[model samples]
Target: MPRILITGGCGFIGSSLASELLCLGYQVTVIDNLSRRGSELNLSRLLAMGAEFHKSDTCDPEALDKLNDSFSCLIECSAEPSVLSGAVGDGARSLLNVNLMGAVNSFEWARRRSVPVIFFSSSRVYPYDRLNACHYRETETRFEFVDGCSGVTQAGVSVSMPLDGVRSLYGASKLSAELILREYALQYGLPAIINRCGVVAGPWQMAREDQGVFTFWAARHYFRLPLQYIGFGGNGHQVRDLLHIQDLVDLVVRQVAALRDRPSDFRGDIYNAGGSIRSSLSLREATEICRRLTGHEVSTASRIEARPSDVIWYVTDNGPTGKVFGWEPKRSAEVVLQDIVAWIKDNASLLKEILV
Candidate 1:
């Protein structure tokens, strides 16, 4: 059995991946700061599931250097995962430290140990301004791209889209890290793979306004909390695609196996991974689904002011990813929401303290 080390393994995506890998008989070790809300709960769960836990911060190179255990692979999941992260005073500095400097530390560790790395990047690396400027028409429930749009496809925004505009500071950090990974792969022959993921949601997510929108919406509806549509004239029509955590883990397992089995065949460095156009939902559509599932009638309001880096429509095109990995998201939006609802209900006592 291979040993896997996951950074930020106490968070939602990291913990979920650790749980699945452990269940599949891999030796999983997790290192996390447990700084985020609800991370302690996730950490406890992972510990109970037999994953070794280390309370450490990735931003500190000294801390990373002190680790003694050897692992076959590293999954870089530690991030400040919010588009609005660097909009305020100290946020910019913090974002750079965690997202950029942290990657450097991970890459350095991988280089020294001669191990492969699986990086969890975000679709936010795509320029926010350019995505907001996409040509689209509004329908009854959501926005649709105009016919013959240059950068978009039936599958959604492709990997070939322009990256010249302003992606938020968070995005810039991630993109910088990606470039560094590429250089390391070329110069040092480091086996690095990047997954540019979008809107990954499921249970165990401590959802917030700027990240994890799906879980945030579901939790708000279930708790009868106020909901709002804040951008694009506040019609609740902004769109995003969803990918379940299980589906993401499935792809990661396949990629990790291939990396160990046939390293030469996994040539593609970066692949856009998400549910694509088929599993996308607008805010309005998501609201209705959440309302139906939660049986709650939460009052909602609209504000015409748009948030910084907010995109009106974003559904990732998984074509390139599927072509390379032979993997695509299997969970539908409804099924994903249903799963979240069940998880929330099952753990209402714990979630209420954090979610509400």
Candidate 2:
């Protein structure tokens, strides 16, 4: 059995991945800080399924030291992506410390053990500097990328795009960590895979302003909470290709399994993991879906300014990932939405526990 360690195993993607691993009969070990509100519930769910749990932060050097040689694979999903870039140098330091430095620490520990490491990166690593420079077409209810080959296919953004001048602090930190992972694979021959995941939504997400917009909206609608649209045009038509957590786990497991069969160097390499054009949806569409599914009134207040470094239309192409890993997302947008709504409805009583 593969002894796997998930660095942020208590969080959204990490917890979902751990649950899948347990179902597949893998011996899973999780290390997490348990700082996030709902992470404890995620951890408890995994523990109920018989996974080994450790309460520790992956950013700590001593904690990394203790994790040495104890697992066959390491999944690094622990990082802060929500801290606003405008919060002075202190916020910048926190992003670097958790997102970049934490990756270095985890990679070093995995390198020492010669174990494969998978890094959960973000789509923000792209060139946000080019966002407002491009024009988008408002077809029907959603926006589409309107330049070059990306327009015709609606296949969404590919990995070949440039990353220069992406001034967003979150993007920069994630890109820096990606570079560190690549260098470790190149310089030290450490095995690593970088997965730039699209908008990840599932039951585990606690719906904060900085992450999990879909779940956030659903929660807000269910509870009649306030929502402010702070990005793009006053019309909440900014598009994103949201992916379900289950699809993400399938990709991670397949990539890790492939590496075990033919361990090769993947230095500085990256892949975009997402649902592609078919799964792309705008906030307008999301709100309507929420209203229809939950039978609740959805309200939106518009703001003049968008979030810093917010991409106008960030979806995945998935061509390279499909070609390389023989994987494609299996669920549709309606399927994901229906499932999430059903999950929320069925577990209404447990929402407090899930939200922690």
Candidate 3:
């Protein structure tokens, strides 16, 4: 088995991926700053499960320099990981340092070692304003994307989407990293794979807003916590596709296998790791599901003012992706919610302090 190195391995996705890889009998080593809530817990969990960990921050290039290992590839998952991250106060500069510059450091390390980079990018890179301006229709239950929108289909937003206009600071950072990574792949011949993923939800996710909207929604409902529909006429009609963490792990597992067995075919490229329409839901729909599963209505509030950084409707078109990875999310929207509810039930006491 090949050794795998994951930056930000204590994060929701990274930790989950590490867990899967460990189970598959891969030698997994992870580096994380342990800054995010529940990161320490994730680190501890990974450590107990036969994964190695080091306290490292991606913002510091020296941190990457000090680490030397014979690994198959570097999985760069470290980021600010929130769409609203830089919207207020001093978060803008911090977001850039952690997201953009941090990625620069990661690419440099990979370039020096001639190691491939498996980047966990974001769907937010597709320009915020363009997504908001996409042709959409508001159904009674939720907002839906309409067909014939340039760069979009009834299925969802495709990779061909234009990259014009303003985007959230978090999105800008991710997009900048993507462009730079592409250059590195071209100039340095780095084997790179960029997964511009959407909302990923499952157990052990600590985020309650912006990035992991599905997890946030599920946690709020499970705990009977206060819930607010903050945008899109306060109806919770704003939408995004939800990918299960395991589905993403399965995708990466195949990717790593491909990189090992078929290196020639692994020419650097980007793909959308999305849940697609099969596993998507609106806040209104989410509330009903959570209500049914958790048996809690929770306090609900509505806000008419929409966040400038937020979109009314967006879903990743996984059509082109399947041609490459032969992958599609098998979990349904309700099944995703059910898994979240189950995770919360199992760890309600510990999660309440972080989630509520």
Q: Which RMSD does model 3 reach against the true structure? A: 1.2
The TM-score that candidate 3 achieves is 0.97
Q: lDDT tens digits, residues 1-356, model 3?
A: 88898999999999999999999999999999988988888988899999988898888889888887588888999988988888988888999999999989988998898888899888888877777776778889898887545788878878888888787888889989998998888887788888999888888788756667778888888777788899779988888788988899889988888777665565468898889987878988999998899898887799999976888887878866777787888888888889988988988888888876
Taking the tens digit of each residue's C-alpha lDDT, what string does model 2 give over 76-184?
8888856365345567776788888888898888888888888988877777666546777887677777774322245777777666655577777888888889988
Clashing residue pairs for model 2? 182-268
Candidate ranking (lDDT, best to worst)? 1, 3, 2
lDDT tens digits, residues 1-356, model 1? 99999999988999999999999999999999987899999998888899988888898888888776578888999989998998876889888999999988988988888778889888998988777777789999998876454567756887788789898898899899998988877788878789999999999998887789899999999899999999898999999999998889999998888788766544329888898788899999999999999999788899999988898888998866776678879999999999999999999999998876
Q: Which residue pairs collide, candidate 1?
A: none
Question: Which of candidates 1 and 2 reaches a greater TM-score?
Answer: 1
The C-alpha stretches of model 3 lying farther than 4 A from their native spots are none
lDDT of each candidate versus the true structure: 0.87, 0.79, 0.85
For candidate 1, give the lDDT of residue 219.
95
User: What lDDT does candidate 1 reach at residue 175?
Assistant: 94
Query: For model 3, which pairs clash?
Result: none
